[model samples]
Target chain A: MMKIVLGSLEKLDFRATVENIRVVESVEQLSKKNNEEITYFLTETEENINAVVRNQEHVYIPATSLLASHQSIGLHIYFDLESYPFYQKVKEMISKEDKPKGVFRFRRTVQHNRNHSLLTGDLYTLSSLLGKPQDIRVKQTDLSVTPSHTIILMNFGGGTMAHIEYTVSDRERIELEWSGIKKIIEFDSDQMVSIQSTRKPTQPLAYSVDAILASARKVDQELIDRLNDFSRLINGGVYS
Target chain B: MKIGIMSFAHMHAYSYANGLTRLPDVELVGIFDDDIDRGKEAAETYHTTHYSDQAGFLALDMDAVIICSENNRHKEMVMHAAKAKKHILCEKPIATNLADAQEMIQACKDHHVILQIAYPVRFSSPIQQLKEMIDNDELGEIIAFRTTNRGQNPGGWFIDEDQSGGGAVLDHTVHMVDIMRWYLNEEIAEVEAIVDSYFHEIDIDDAGLLTFEFANGVVASHDASWSRFTEYPSWGDATIEVIGTKQTVKVDAFQEHLRMFTNEKKSLEYVFWGNDMDFGLIQDFVNCVKEGREPSITGYDGLKSLEVSLAGYESSKLNKTVHL
Candidate 1:
């Protein structure tokens, strides 16, 4: 799992901001005292401007050239930008006053996606409509083949900022261009399997959970049938 | 290579000056903003020369020039650079309109010069890797994708339609559109989008959404906004996600350096914010110029992206789909 440590001094009182940002050291010590291990470390943002994050083993400092005042204190582990979700969610929950002086921090893991597309009926239709080409013939079924390493950058709040990508073969492709004022979703083969249904007012939670559980119970049978079909198609017991 | 900046009117001009000075092989030749005070300030802070006119600055004999001028002024700057035959790095939305952008491209081509639009995201390491994975068929097929560039309102000249061409969509949409074309390696066949003023006091739309359908049956959505309030911890970011037949991957390309702290009675806190895209972009432009190659994102890419942005504006006004 990729971990990111972020700190910011939005409050004019520098002492309080530094004090708040120093929590990473304690967190590191806590990881050592306990069995929780630290894998990768990234030192970015203003905290590292004064050589604050240095000489630490496995710590990677990408760039310090463009550091600016009046921004957030943060660090990112690994180069994958997707791992910053916990910080974003925590940042979103923060109130204006509590942001600086009122110490508040939270952490959450992004549930790695395992499904291709978890589209509602409306979303599916809209997606299909958008896929049509005026000069050429395009089929929805043809678009069904999965690209690897899909990412969906959605704006929970309304804005013209979202990103989606996929890796087909070894080439990373930007499947969608940035358009303003729209919802965004990115999904590919490996990440598609984990997409559980989103909860909604119309659908009761208990009912959806039960339905999902029932589907899970059939996995064994489904696997057996799929294996049998493959064997028959291949004209041999390839499993041996 | 010694590089200098010509203007500080663009949002990215200050960072370009800093980056040029920071790179090992590059020396900062100084910066010049049309506004004399702005030029002097950037020059003093960046420790470079501040020239009052193009002739004086071009005569400084710098290896390259970055035109971080207004959208309307890009062609003139490029023409001057063309006459000088110096390599040029430029900001995105390369021109206020398509004709001007074309002229800039032509001038560079005629002069046998490198004209690279400073679309740093194309040079982003992770994005480069993502492109590789997609081309390799690790994912079976690209089903769909979405992208967005949103942030706090950029007032001043950005609000003027003549100065900026349009509002949020115009200012922000081109980069994403270019990224999309680069990723798919295909043309955008048709598009439908909406532009509107919401939560902004300006005459133009502070928010917009565009939907695109590629010829390959891959669907896309792009969102651009400048209405986000700065009171929020961070303003906004450029993010992309691609959904394929088999899996999903998301790119959070927002640049920030942050830290947190807590004591006996408290919790999380923000220590700093470092949002820098120019460092990578400047390095890329210099590399391309040194190597005698076109940029990963070229001026033509800027023109196409701007076309998509403008198409969205037209679609929203007409409430109809557009073919590109």
Candidate 2:
């Protein structure tokens, strides 16, 4: 049984969300550290059964998209779902294979001098249509030696495009747009963060939840590799 | 002047009939339709006599006949009307085959009658403005064209290959190609296309993405499809994006609409309040008949567009770009 530990207060709400889950064997209390860094995803490791998410600062999400709960076929943990402000109603999504047309707007807030990163929600949303990032870019601000803002743009071919802007703020918020629907997800506070679905910001689409999650995870790993290069350039150390 | 309609099989017949009503100089003498119920209904709607026999309808004292039959039947209807010495306004894609289109053109000439093809897009205000821009050198020398003609699948004879000649590609490609040729005064030289039945479960192709080069070395891309879902705000769209040396202009022919969100059948609706293109077409045909002049859109214009559209299908079948 792969054991995932949610930070501090989510023990009850996590159970409530995945109460009908059948694939998950058990949940155990892992280490509870109070590190308010990034509130996103960590993929399940093959050997390490215990995964720790630091503090009320972040929610521990296994590599999965938001619509996975509706699909019930994959191993997914429902957490921080109600916290997002837009596209909370996943049931009303159009599930057909609609090759998304038009531009994508992706926004993420980082506390550090975080230039740019694709947030988990839009990562899944985009990765569904654009399998692997054919291209990933971080615009050079040149405003300061340690610039605090980052803008990233990705092209999925056939005019399907996405742009992500990372602005350094004290809090965490993420936004993404597909077609006419814009999905914005963020924390109301540092305590219990509930991810909301736009059912803002959208008429949700039922992309292959697990497939999109897997795709998003692959893309995230690529971004991390790119960020690692940035870390070496700035701090001369690998970014955690 | 008195005018008559040959068939009500094509939906445009109703609009053309209404155009006849809007004109003070013309009178709709009668209507003839092979489909008896359709003929009777249209006759009642337009307040005209229904003539079941094609010969009897041709014998009426009408100066012209608007042929709105199926694609395959257009040749026969136009022939009969031309022999009767009635100036003809035939629905587009002239005929199912080039030979038939040639024969229709010959028949009109032999009978000394005007043979006009109903290509209403030219009459659209935006299309006219684009032509004006080109004439005035406002956009400099024309470079390229990107156009889309997508409509909701008018299921029925439109989807039947036997009656309609082809599907969305054939139904839509002709209109845009006609306009493009008129604008550039160039013939299509090459065609490469990807055609498939993506929108509907039917066997006929409902989508076609076509790319071709005009004689003047100008490349053009056309997206023709019946992929618009039922709940879509508007019926469909015909948009042209013209790339010029000085400026690039994009015009959505049906963009003059009010977006309304109400609880009436559809949650979102686009009520179009644009200029009536059909009326313009009918008016032009009437002027040609009275003045004894060739129409702005003639049978050859229809034939050339049909040739390019058919070449797209040939390219798809051969899986290689075909030269015309």
Candidate 3:
């Protein structure tokens, strides 16, 4: 049996999904578990990650360990724009790109007054994707009577440009327009991703949560399959 | 109701003038712009008379005047309208600064004129539904908001700091800030922001990320950037994510649009299909004038939102959080 230990359950809504796995309350108990046991650490503290890594005899997974197993996992690392320092860092990093070429626009519309740090996570991902160019420039312009109805233009090297327009005064939809692509991707907060493309002019994909979940599951399963293969190679087929 | 447009500097004057013509029992009396040629052109386009002199424009027997002047000139036009005792629907930000905004509000109040700020996003149907949900506590206690109000930069006087006051920070922060204040019914206590002139070869800053702390402990962040490209499918978007203790909701005001790709344009374009928010806003102002009721979006609302934007600029300059 595959016995998995969870470090912390606070604020985690995925508890029900992990019901089949063995969950221990304390790190001591986790440490005592057999080498075959897999431990998952979800806390933000560096101490917990250190504790797990220190126990080299056992197989442990930090929150970020799974990130390397997949490409899109980086998108899940929420960027907290609420923190002043982090916001500045992000701004600086995005500005550092010299002659960056590409259009990256992120427009997020929300329903109430809430913390948005988590929503900006994709900014880093987008910046990373665009790479460093010869020059990058950013400009903000206000275009509407509504407060906060502003657009941010990012000019990368060459003719590539990215625009992010945000308005709390409007409805809620996360829309992204990329250069060289014939379609725009609209991500609903409910985890539904729809493609509005010129190729399928008449068949705009309706927002569907199941479709997104299914795609995410496929990626997750691929990661799991790779882990299973690694386990088998390390500890013989018995672990598999 | 006989109404006059104060200036043609801002492009919305055309839409407002056209909307007035479509409204029942409302007359677009005349067009008044500082530039005689521009004013005359707008008047001809709207089939109205042009008034070159400020005194002559105010002297007209008008029920109200819509101030669509440049950012710096809003105070002068609004004060003039107030003196005329005409119910006013002034454009956003109220004024370029807190002092100017307060003066405009006080003048309107002293003159017994209804001062409504043009915030059409409040009139969006999806936004109204979101407000209803918040009011009903469907999301439980509100926690924070992440919003973006972005659009393509309208180059011209907009890029000139003297004419427009500030760039994206000043122009963009007010709309979503107004919505946030209305939804949470709380004042913003703190602000931290980053404003940069990273795009375009302009003198003014065009991109900004503003964070806020509400008096009620709710925190929010906004991306008020004029960052849209010419090839963008639509003008831009107004999007917000409402995070509450119990649940979260997202509102995208411009999502209800149809995508079209034609040979003439060569690129894809989004044709919005939602109800005309501008029409709703103008109708509300007209109804308030006729019913003798205070406008739903008041001058104070404009002042409060403008304060946040001004604070954003202060925060950027100081590289620290500003207390409202």
For each candidate, what's the DockQ? 0.06, 0.03, 0.05
Candidate 3 wrong stretches, greater than 4 Å:
A1-60, A63-240, B264-266
Give lDDT tens digits, candidate 1, residues B1-324.
Answer: 878788898868877777777788889886767799989988888877788788878877777899988777788888998879888888878887889889989998999888888887776666666778788866556766667787778788888887777888888788777877887888787777656675566797787667787887677767777745554334567777666655556675664436455563324334435445568888878888788887777878888887788888887677567888
Please tell me the TM-score of chain B in candidate 3 relative to the true structure's chain B: 0.98
TM-score of chain B of 1: 0.92
Candidate 3 residues A1-240, lDDT tens each?
A: 232322234323342243334445555766665544333433444444445443333323322333333233212122222112223343444455564433455666543322122223233334444542222222221222222332333334344445444554334555544422222234333244244555643221121211112112212455445444432322223212
**lDDT tens readout by residue for model 1, A1-240:** 222233222211222222122234433452443222332222345555334333232222221111122112232112111112322222233322221111010111122221222111111221222321111111122322324232222222222222223233322211212222222122222233334456622211111111111112111343334333322322322222
Clashes of 3: 63
Give, for candidate 1 chain B, the lowest lDDT window spanning 10 residues.
B264-273
DockQ of candidate 1, scored on C-alphas against the true complex (2 decimals) = 0.06
Candidate ordering by DockQ (highest first):
1, 3, 2
What are the TM values for chain B, all candidates? 0.92, 0.99, 0.98
Superior candidate under DockQ, 1 versus 2: 1
Q: Which stretches of candidate 2 lie over 4 Å from their true place?
A: A1-240
